[model samples]
Target: MKFQKPDFNPRIMPPKLKVLTLEVEKFDNNFAGVCYKNGRRYVIDGAIPGDVVKAAAVESFNNITYCGLLAVVKPSEKRVRPKCRYYDSCGGCDFMAVGLKDELAFKTDYVRRRLFPFGTEVRDAATEKGFRNKITLAFEKTNGKLNVGFIDDKTKKVTDVSECLMHEAVFSDLVKALRFWIEDNDVSIYVPRFGTGTLRFAVARYLDGQLLLTVVGTKSLPSTEDLYKKLKKRFPKVGLFENVNAEKTNEAVVGDVKHLYGEKFIESEMLGIKFRLGPDSFFQTNAAVCGKIYEDALEIVRGKNPSVVYDMYSGIGITSALFSRVAKKVVSVEIVKKAARAQKELLSENGISNVEVIEGDTEEALKNVAVEKGGVFFVDPPRRGLSGATEEILRFEPKAVLYLSCNPDTLVKDVEKFVAAGYKAVSATPYNMFRATTHVEIMVLLEKIENDE
Candidate 1:
């Protein structure tokens, strides 16, 4: 028996695949449909809830399976033709095939599920199309030719998108102009694998009839002056910047930046407050939806009339300026020095003297700030949500805490912490900030219990 061992190859015996028709129960936050078959659940991409699709099991993991849609046996009533020609290949929009009404409903329901038992009001974006104020396009080299656009979902290749439906018309014009400029100048595209080439990403921010364009590259190119001239000609009120990102990493933009032409920052107004945005400053993409969120947040803290308000993670002090209008004094904490400096300039230009900008880490800065009782804390953390400073901020025992989150999962986790710290989640509101995408923004108001301390 020991000498009779036979050689076998695992590749020769593949798992049997069965094509089955499954009805999608619901769609998750990522736009992947959840379908149940024979008492087991399967996740199918490109399938919407209420759709019956013929799919084959692609892979199995743990208790659930993943399948690839073969054909739509019965399409959902919510299904619609995607407006953008690139929607089929481009990975930017997942819900494009679904109707906008259905998309909003799914997002609202997703938020409700995450923050169960908390009353919520869902607000849709004013306009579903052309709402993005900023767009970042990636550059790639394929077959010794320059390619620029979004990455495809299935092929994992760069899809040459002449226009994106989510961005304004001017953005499309700029993209076309930039692509032409690159081709005419024979610009070298950055290839991260080999750590060679030049241009990496083209990021454009449009606001108040002006544009801020940041070209990220591995090194400075001699053609920047000409490229700037071409862009300025097309976009009269354009600010051109070259961001040198020499590292071999996946980050789109980082490291030293130099202003090539026009103003270093573009001025934009939100909620009657002026803001100076730089190429790297973080501003909400959907201005209309963002304004509504801010208005609601302001309303929540207006009644408190706190003597001092802490605007944590304040980017260029938009929220801080808004708080200054209500609170006697507002302190903004931001780790980015340039952003903090811009905030200071914005406040001074607007004659807003009540707000003070602190350029330092939020956690460290919170420790030094005077924790006055009855103060209001307005936190707008990143997608990962609150860091280790959650407990430290709670120690202040602020009169109220308003949390603005882009990821509901993380928001719910942090809300649990706030609840344990004797704060009650009074209201949670979801905003459809990013249309045709699975992402959503939520604002939660937490009030401290009177006798918790």
Candidate 2:
């Protein structure tokens, strides 16, 4: 069965809104302000922690109220003004309205709360603006005209982006050029209902001083060469590409891709290891914070003194490449053939030969690969976490299993499963990969529970 992401476009009707005044006590896992009004728990957006705000109840389900911020009657001292102009509309940065100090404090408790009873250490990952290496803007209709930017969390409409603090300044300028080109050339934007348009999305990635731009539309535009020539004049090192996405699906970048100009791939250095990135590469947006997480994981690996390392579900083999520096041999199992081949090429480029790339599903590949008893298994799965791979890892019974998760909800559940299987979570650390937001990267180390003498 093919997998599909939920379509973001949904028709919204105006509903009767109820008003209430509440004092926000703290932040929930989603970074929304949680307040109690007359014994009813309300989750309010745009209201910071420790704030007295008036909100309109949007709806209620399961005895919990969901609302939108009406006004901040009394603002909290910890609430700092947003730095990004698009903070009010753009859903790209969820925590733009929050101060750095408070953001970290909430993330710390957020991770510790889920992994209770385990000693959790949340690192300081406060980063500045323009930390993202990639940007994807969708082309849609707004106010009877074409616009491009991120989707609004509430409205699900494209917000025109002229300046974004999350991405490089060049990307913002490129967005302006693309929007103008769409308006000047009179390009048709994709309409989900009618399902007709020339343009659908614009993807741009910056790596090592070069830009890889891609235009996603129903079909190739006639004026694509002209747009490329314009971008080339402004930015010398730029590559333009096209991704034809005709299906009405949630995926922004899909279909057959063709290189329009310049280089086809961009090389970026991550964690002191240089690797190539394409339009569809699963690269981390924040390089600095990603480096911090990898470095910490390597330090933990060193203390284990493993003879070999097993990297399961390794995407592009970034962790495998880094783990190869210390361990005698590292095996990376990846399902994607393209990423597996690229990992081989990347390892060869750096003259590292101890790492082996196995192209197959992690669960199936785990049966074929042989792991030593003193080795560590590192698994970085998707948001769904390990499905049936739990039994596979238990069968291997490595010295330790390192689970890196993007969703804490799944992490807690998986950790309990391991605990029941004779494993104890030794330590959990949260990395603020996406700063100014509740989304975090956590690494939990689980060691086998040996019978005491």
TM-score of each: 0.91, 0.92
The 10 consecutive residues of candidate 2 with the worst lDDT sum are 2-11
Give the per-residue lDDT digits (tens) of candidate 2, residues 399-442.
89999898888888888889889888988777778876668888
Residues 1-453, candidate 1: write the lDDT tens digits.
111212212223235766679999997656688987677878887889889998777766666777777779898988898998887668689778887778777777777677765443444323333378998888887887666788675665678887778877786788777887798888888777788888888888998788988898888865777777788877878888989889867677887678898878788788888888888888889888888888888888898888999999998888898999888999899998888888898899888999878899888998898878789999999888997879879878898999999877788888899888888887777777888888778788888878834
Clashing pairs in 2: none
Please, what's the RMSD in Å of model 1? 5.7
Evaluated against the true structure, the overall lDDT of model 2 is: 0.79
Misplaced by over 4 Å in model 2 are 1-15, 119-130
Score residue 44 of candidate 2 by CA lDDT: 81
lDDT of each: 0.81, 0.79
